[model samples]
Target chain A: MSTTKYFAPSVEYAAKILIYLSRYKSKQSTLTEISKNLDINKSACLRVLKTLEANNFVYYNSETKKYSLGTYISVLGKRVGENLDYLRIINQFLEEVCELTGLTAALVQRVSFDRVMFISQYQTQIQPRLSISVGNRFPLTEVSYGKWILANVSEEERNYHLREGLKKVTSYTRTNLQKYIDELSEIKRSNILVSRQEYTNNVTAISSALYDWKGQILGMIALVGVSSLIDEAEEQRLCTVLKEVTNRCNEHLIQLKIEAYEFPYESKITQ
Target chain B: MSTTKYFAPSVEYAAKILIYLSRYKSKQSTLTEISKNLDINKSACLRVLKTLEANNFVYYNSETKKYSLGTYISVLGKRVGENLDYLRIINQFLEEVCELTGLTAALVQRVSFDRVMFISQYQTQIQPRLSISVGNRFPLTEVSYGKWILANVSEEERNYHLREGLKKVTSYTRTNLQKYIDELSEIKRSNILVSRQEYTNNVTAISSALYDWKGQILGMIALVGVSSLIDEAEEQRLCTVLKEVTNRCNEHLIQLKIEAYEFPYESKITQ
Candidate 1:
């Protein structure tokens, strides 16, 4: 997957149109509107939108001459939920964590080299609880999952990532280089990372890394709650439950030997 | 949304790539395999794929030199679920139907001019039950929802749609034009559609249309079970429950006046 100078500007604009529609999904947008807002030529926007509508990625309302996100989006989402075995399995564990701890539990997977995303979540029914939704993304150095990743990687690589230093997300965020590195060392030893109001103010999160059969980091199981509702004792108790669940999850992953599962679609790039 | 001869070939190919990845989501595919399978020019495919990867619509695994569906797919899916107000409300009603009748409940929405997709479903826990997933699409002339749709439309339009006749999905499928029209007329009077083994073998379904405050056809609420488990008496009972629920749902929609809800993002296309 070497970086290539060749690019498809039409495809890029098409993606932009889809994302713009996603933000205003409840409303319909006309081609001219999309073109002006996205700053693409009107003719080009129409072509892209028509191609998308032809594929059911966007729904065009003929009566009103407007477009919205289409049913294919739901279909793709369903595929993501069903085809990913690990996501399916982790969702059940997330539900259990939400029920047991009365806190929002989320499964965050590394989506790219520098981003981790919440792919699944079970919100607690408890009042004044923290809420997290699937698809929320954070930078690799900005969340508890990032802490786990940084702790587990080679020291050289970790240092390379840390060269920019951490941004202060909240008042409690650890931006000091020495202190943050010390915390990463502790995370490496304990396999658990806890932060209060570091990502979002008034929220405390307890996160632990999960591994697959190959001993590769798969994702992070994070439990979060309102800081006002969690005292020191409650945090400790919730942390224990979270650790136990992640440990069980990792053990189950090893027993399943999931990494060895066949991927029949490999087409080697000869280039 | 006038039909246009103009098309963006690159955008179309990009969509095809994403859909292909969706089918083989658990595995990664090499650029060559994607190009060969999709018959897209190798260079063109690489450019589109690189654009997709840059946008997080596809993830490139550097070590394996392969690509898979990316996190943006999940994000777009999340947008569909969260932004569609009716889908969210109907989901709760579907859950109730599942609990009340111990049958799989689903919400079907018209997607395109001639297609309807299963956008939401709640599978039954009962043994020997049917299972349905979101995104399963069918022609508007086939399923129970189609029955409601056909019945609701003008006679001339309905006759035109009926001219081709229905396909024989099973021995019980109604293929005779007149007989199908008669059944649709019955549905018109009762506002309910009952189908057994018409879409799939051994599956019995009862569906009714839901309406917004404007009385337009919103979608269908369907309850399905194994035909063997649903005798004539059981079917009648289930029909009654389905009708009652849909009526309640309609009343709720009217009260909410959901269509009156503001869509702040409407930018009209001034030709």
Candidate 2:
């Protein structure tokens, strides 16, 4: 099998096992299930799981003979420390957004090329309210949280990012390449990104980018709720609250910036 | 070179590199610096860093020739999922404890054999307060949080855990093995663990094991502050608050159990 240079297949496979178990449908996946789904040999899969288990990167249940992501990931992630205070501040803002708009709000940070993870979330008392899981991921090219990040990058960067076809998440999602790029540019101009049944069919979300005092993109502040409760005019009002909170957050978060980006996500792509 | 069964040296080294960069005294580490510190060959170090960067497990700053932990760790950890609500509950209790005691409070979770990771922390308006980073680790066999968890385990399990020599973290720390085991047994009776300038000088911490409704130890809830502010009476009062908050938390967190515990941390040791 051909692999990229500098990529160790064993190590990559180990990491994949971890990422896979975190998203596994069940709380744990058996060796046979993992090997089959992840396309690895059974022995190699066991070996990888064993190594992960040894390091507490994954836990194995002897009775079920299944594997799950370990607490070590959370421990290591927390040690990525500089942004702790920033996340706390974002969480407080999320609470206010949820409170003011009678909806749920979340702070979404880009996790990878294809995913943005929720760092913090707040739920309102509004009946039939919806809330996203804190550590769950959304597609970068699909969800408004992900698209806000995608839209802010330069054209060259955006092209390199979406070199692969944009996978449609829902029927309402824009699929045409030119149209998608055009929409991203439009969102950038408006400085408010919205998704109505684009990511999940019943949810409506409006998001805006957070910037530090130095003009660096920190993450995205999103106001999310049940689609039935939010409308065009209401979304516009929530955007106002989001902007105010983000502006206040920018003042406090200026010093807590995680300056290391994805090396411009392919420093080569940028060049 | 001989390596333990199921342990991939390269994957282990890559994880080590990520952990190292996180705790590195400096903001970033150069290839030579990491190689020299971690005792890996320069070529191997370069290869690991490159692979980690490609996977966004590490970030490479070409201009500075430095490496730092990547955002993937945080993202993946968040996706671990089951503990998110529990962590949020813990954070709330911490805030309440901190508010009541006029001290800093933290929730600590066992992350490994020898360490517990901070899950949440809050500081009050009291002057000269102390706090720890949420993701930072403390030795399980040394500090109050670790000792609390250690105390609950069977003596056989405890002995198996620290088969290796326990390193002294501070001058006042108990270093004698027999004395350590005896002290652990004694502390279990009192149900409160205190570190009087043991882990770090001038910081006093008193902790109690936070348990779920099932009576399994979830983690430790600690009330910490400058030693000057915490007298014998204050410590007692704070413990009351800590227990009350943890009890309230247990009610909310009963449904959020992280059931995937390490499969008998000493399976090999038992053999």
Candidate 3:
């Protein structure tokens, strides 16, 4: 077996470059400008820039030595827009959950290792909502959605992520690996994860996985609000609503021909 | 003078890889999969993927060997959402214009060389709204928004984009360079670009430029509807409404401290 693990190192670099570009897409940036701004080595940056230019990610004015994002960046922008339309189908359901629970509702997904991305959110009319951008990422190990995803991940993958030690994002975050793993197993069995300010203080969040037709986790739906508003009773009610709304969303996905899958692998150790 | 352009090569490569990744983001292809799909050498794909990976634009599962988008993909998603918020701010104005003219009202931005991204839209009650995604891009040299953007682009950039001939996307699209440039100049001075079935037969569109506080062309506001409903009188009314709405948006941008600039340079050649 060829033991070379496919490390997509360049993809990571390109993504970093794109994020850097997002901040200044409206303006032109020179090669040295990008290198200095990003702290990337000049020669490597030059090579990447050449590849990007050839591919249409940017256009370089040979005369002025200026570079701007190419038209294709907008193509990706368009895809993002199309993906957002998927959220509209669940908006009403999310709003109802928010109204019924008096909590801020959110949709989130585990986009990568140790990072959970917020997809959409609905705020209660009275309580102030968390300022979470749709595409913003937070530490996966320290969030309710993160735990939910961890609950579903394979043991090998879980160990890989956990080996780094859950970087403490907040004082309330779980620090013990065994405890965190146990909690994930429990949540996996029960299909819900609840935390009292795991990511922030004075906030309670209860989340359930949003599954496709075949039971694969597409994302998580959660209700978060002031800790005072979500006691055990409120948590139960929120869970009930979360389950119902998630099922409704799954049905919508089914209509769209998406299959939901259960966690694909069996847990190695019995809890 | 050091004539060697910096960031040009990297920008080019970035654009190419981004376009490639976009074609597969929805499909969830692996690096090997992308290599095959793009018909590029696997080693090159690996290099590109590594760069994208480091930047959080693409992610791969070492266990499953599956590749998907990373957290940074959401950065563009958030941009579209922010732009949607901008559209929301002007929705009332667009709705009023739609009602006044019995046409479909839209907010568009030049997203690429030949594409206009639709930000938001409202259709008159009687007319079925043209279904366009919030991030959808249309060619800039063909439709009303395209013509408007072409008219507003600096002479140099405009010539650069037009040198290879505008991509003919629709049957009524103009292929002649000089004629189109001439028409664009007329539209630029008049502050309006009108198209009759240029993008789609039976659809007539009239557009005006949206400017920032400093009066720079930010985007275009357009009205589209069936040709029968868009006579000379209707075109005049729609043009007036577009100008007024654009002015309101500009005032809003001014309040937000955005600078508007006109096309950087004027063409030397005259009709």
Candidate 4:
């Protein structure tokens, strides 16, 4: 909450270790393996892990002589996931979108500046539905969801990722940095972004940003399917429905803002 | 993990603040209120909260000048929620229980020394089912889920909470420590626990522990509904289905152990 950043080394290291555990692996790891892989000294790692364990941030198994994150971490994560008013709003709206359009409808959240987390998703009744589990995190710059978020962040932050150079995932990947920036600006201006075979060979995605009552970008709500499902006529329909989803979310969020006094931690997705 | 406990005061205090926030209030609290209420020094509270905020463990709303837990907490909670293999295994098994008995089914985990957490739940197709959400936490000495976990923990740890004296929530609430201890022992020896309106009126719960391959109690799976639904005739059917559910989870956990070699973290629930 401080205007000036206050750094705490032990706290920072503990967080880094948790992020590493969450990102790199889900199973138990030995002190040796964690210390070596994360490059923290064994003794200090022992202290922090001990602290984390005592606080229910990590769990230690004596028989296996290894460590894994504790269940309390999910208690925290549930709080985070619960704070997204859009998730509540998207429930009926996403289902309706899927019902009307016969495609997958999803809500993604920007976890890190350059990574988006799939928080909620629904699949249509069509055969051979595209399925991805909730809580899946991916690089924002590599997928259509990435462009949807990249379009909202500050131009400097977007340029930082641009300067890192977008990798060619498919032949259609945009390699021109300037053109990519231009494309992002246009997406931002238009409030929609489209991708065809940018991450995988056959999948195509169309995404539009979901906004809170104050107009801050929360993330993207999108409808996706195979490339064949996204033909010229379908794209227009998809855009219209996707736009409707966002508008509905915004409306629900405004209602939630009115309902804010009834609870704490409401409408926290303004950013 | 070391056998001897090494106390970290700072870490301990930080956890206490978080717990207080979770238990006492879900809304934003100020430094003065938290400091005076928790009896922590304002300066020290500021430092710890700032550290927590830095790690995305807490969020500060500059507009209202208040603090609530950050979204990252739920991100961690989701990870922990994802780790509960029984939740994954009990999906089909729970539906079977609900289908056979027309009652709600659920899974609960031991979250703290004196508390149990509801991690997964399923509703029956029948109208007016008893509903308790996932992530709901209650005192370990009061609920059927508590007795299931109390039956497993060390005698000393169990006695500490027992000494706290269970409050009378309903007419069936067990307030006598001796009776509570006897109840827990019977449940532990029998490997199951049942509650008839011990916590809430007109509700009944029957629970049995789910163990990993190592025979450690990972959590509990049960069917619960209106007290009338838990009639003796129905109790037998509930036990049969619940046991099947536990067996299915154990089999899945063993399969996971075999698959552990393919990933870095595995068989973590043994802790």
DockQ of all models, two decimals each: 0.30, 0.26, 0.21, 0.28
Model 2 agreement with the true structure over B99-174: per-residue lDDT tens digits = 8888888778776555777766788767787767766777677676777777777777788767885778888787
Output the number of the TM-score-best candidate. Answer: 4
Write the number of the candidate with greater TM-score, choosing between 1 and 3. Answer: 1
Please provide, for model 4 over A70-165, each residue's C-alpha lDDT reduced to its tens digit, 9 standing for 90 to 100. 666655555544543334456678788888888888777676545677766789769767876565778867776887666666665666666778
lDDT of 4 at A139: 81
How many residue-pair clashes does candidate 2 contain? 1
Best prediction by DockQ: 1
Residue-level error in angstroms, candidate 3, position A153 = 5.9
Which CAPRI quality tier does the interface of model 3 achieve? incorrect
lDDT, candidate 3, A1-271, per-residue tens: 0122444433434555555555434345778887787777878777666555544354455434655554345446555323433445566677878787778888787654457777667886684665556666677665668887777677787786677887676788878888988898898787777888878788888887766555567678887777776678877878887878777777786665443222222321221
Q: Kindly list the per-residue Cα lDDT of model 2 for residues A97-148, writing each as its tens digit.
A: 7788887787777755556777667887778878777667766776667777
- Winner on lDDT (1 vs 3): 1
Cα lDDT tens digits for candidate 4, B1-271: 1233443445555666665555425546777777788887777787777777655566555445566665456555655545534344555666766787778887777765556787666786687798876657887766778777666666766676577688888998878888887887787676666788888899888887776656667677777888875678877777777777666766876655411111001122122
Chain B TM, every candidate: 0.77, 0.77, 0.68, 0.76
The lowest-lDDT stretch of 10 consecutive residues in candidate 2 chain A is A262-271
Q: Which candidate leads the pack in lDDT?
A: 1
The positional error of residue B43 in candidate 1, measured at the CA in angstroms, is 4.5
